[model samples]
Target: MPLWWHLMKSVPSLQIVLHRIAWSAVIVGAFLFWRDGRGWLKRALSKPNTWWMLALSGVLIGFNWGLYIWAVNAGHVVESSLGYFINPLLNVLLGVVFLRERLGRVQWMSVAIATLGVAWLTFRFGQLPWIALALAASFALYGLIRKLAAVDSIDGLGVEGAYLFLPVVAMLVWSETHGQGGFFDGYGVAMSVMLVVSGALTALPLVGFAYAVRRVPLSIIGLLQYVAPTMQFLIGVFVFHEAFDRDRAVGFAFIWIALAIFAIDGALRARRANARAPLVPAASPR
Candidate 1:
C-alpha cells in the first residue's frame, strides 16, 4: 500500500486515504454481507455504543493510515518502520492501564527495556519520535476499543468503514471539483486499477487481525506482531538504505534484546502451563 501511495505522488495524501478507505469499505462490506447476510448487520447496527466505539476507532485507524502513507511517501520509511516496531509495546502498556491486566515481572522488565530503547532513539534524533509514537498509540487504542466492544471482526470493520465513508466521499468530491482527482484524470488505466485494488490491500489483513484478537490473548498477539515491524525495518535498512549508524543500532539493539526476553518468558510460561495440565483417563466401557 505504501508503494502504491508513493507511486500516486501526484495525488493528494488525503485523496489517497479516501480512495483506499472507500474501496476497502466496499470489499469488507461485501464480505460481511456474504458471510452473515442482513441479520448480523442489523444486530450490529442496533447498539448505540457499538456505533460510538466504532466511530472513535474509525478516526484513530484513519489517522494511522494517513500518517503512515505520508511517512512512507515522504521518504520516512525508516521512521514508519520504527512506528510499527513500537506498536506492540504500546499495546502491552494499554492492556495494563486500560484493560486492568497484570503483567508478569519479566514483562514489566521488557517494557522498561523497550522504553529505554525509545528514549535512546529520541536522544539521538534530538526530537520526539512522533511518527512512531503516534502509530503505536493510535493502533493500541483501536485494538483496546475493539476488544472492549466485543464485536465480531467483520461487523466491527463494516461499521467503522461506514463511519469513514461519508467524509471520504466528500473528500473525493472536493478533489474532483479542484481538478486534482487522480481516479478519472489521465493517470492511466493501470494506476486507476491499482488505486481501486488498494481497498482489498487495506482491509484483508485487518479482517484477519480483528478476528485473531477476539480469539487470542493480547499478549500472544503482541508477540506475533513483531513480524511486521521486523520486516519493515529490514526493508527500510536493506532496500531503502536508510541511515543506521552505531547510535541508532544501539537503540534498536535494546529493543531486540527486550523482545528476546519477552519471547523467552512467554515460552517458559507456556511450557509450565502445559506441564501442569492433568491428563484425563479413558472411561471404562459399561
Candidate 2:
C-alpha cells in the first residue's frame, strides 16, 4: 500500500504514453549511438539472432500499447485500468512460472486474493476482462522474453524499431504518394513531436528499468515497479472519468486489501532482515 504520491504529472494518457515512447526512443537511441556508434549499429544490423528475439518482443509490446491506447480512447478505461492493476500479479506469476522464483506463504496468499478479486470482477461484470488480461499477459511475457534473451535494452530496442519502422515507413510513403496518408501532417506540432521523439520516450523507462534490474534485486525492483501502474490507475479513475460501479468498487477494494497484506508481509520480512530501507507508506488517495 505504498502511497501513490503524485509523480511525473503530465499531459493526457494518450499524449503521455505517446510522448513517453517518443522521448524514450530518442534518448535511448542516442545512448546506443554514443556507447558504440557505428560498430553497434553494424553489430545490431548483422545479428539476425538478436533481431529475431527482439522482433517478437517488439511485436508484443506494440500490440500491448496499441490495445492499451485503444482501450483508453474507446471508453474502455475501466478495462485498461484493470489491466494495470493486474500487471504486478502477472509479473509475479511470470517469475514463478518462468524463472522458478519461489513465493512465500504471504506472497502466495496475496496472489490468491488477487486472483479472487479478478474472478469476482469478471463474474460481476459478466465478461472476461480481456483488455486487462491481454495487457497483463502481453507485458509479462515480453518481460520474460527480454530477461531470458539477456539483450541490451536500448540497442535491442533500436533493432526492434528498425524492424517495425521499415514496414511502417513503406506504408507511410506509399499512402502519401497515393494521397491517402495523414501522418506527419494532420497533427502539426503533435505529429512532429511524435515522429522525432516516440522511440526515445518508449525507450527511457526501459533503460531505467534495465539499469534498475542490475543495481537492485529483482524482488526490490518488482516492488518499486508498482509505481508506474499505480499511476496509470489513478489517471484512469481521476483524469479519465471512468465510473466506479459496485462491482468495480468491490473488486478494487479486494485488490487494495491484497496489496495491504502483501505490503505488510514485505515490511515484516524486511524488518526481520534488519534492513535500513525506508518503509513505503500505506496511504493512496482513492
Per-model TM-score on C-alpha atoms: 0.91, 0.76
Encode model 1's per-residue lDDT on 1-286: one tens digit a residue.
4556778776667777888899998898899889888786777767668879989988998999988888877777777877777776788888888889899999999989989999999998898788888888898899899888778778888989988998898888888888878678656788778778888899999888877877897557757877778777777788778788898888888888888897888878887887999999999999
How far does residue 143 in candidate 2 sit from its true spot (Å)?
0.6
Query: lDDT score, residue 252, model 1?
Result: 82
> Would you give me the overall lDDT of model 2?
0.68
- List ranges where model 1 is wrong by over 4 Å: 46-48, 209-222, 280-286
Predictions in order: lDDT: 0.82, 0.68
Worst 10 residues of 1 by lDDT: 1-10
Per-residue alpha-carbon lDDT of model 2 for 1-286, expressed as tens digits? Answer: 0011112122233333444344444566678889887676667556446657778887888778767765666666666667776777778788998899998988889889988888898899898888889998998888787777666766677766656665555655676577654445654665545544545545666777767778886557657766766776677677767787787888877777777788778767777776766678999999
lDDT of 1 at 66: 89
Sequence-dependent TM-score of model 1: 0.91
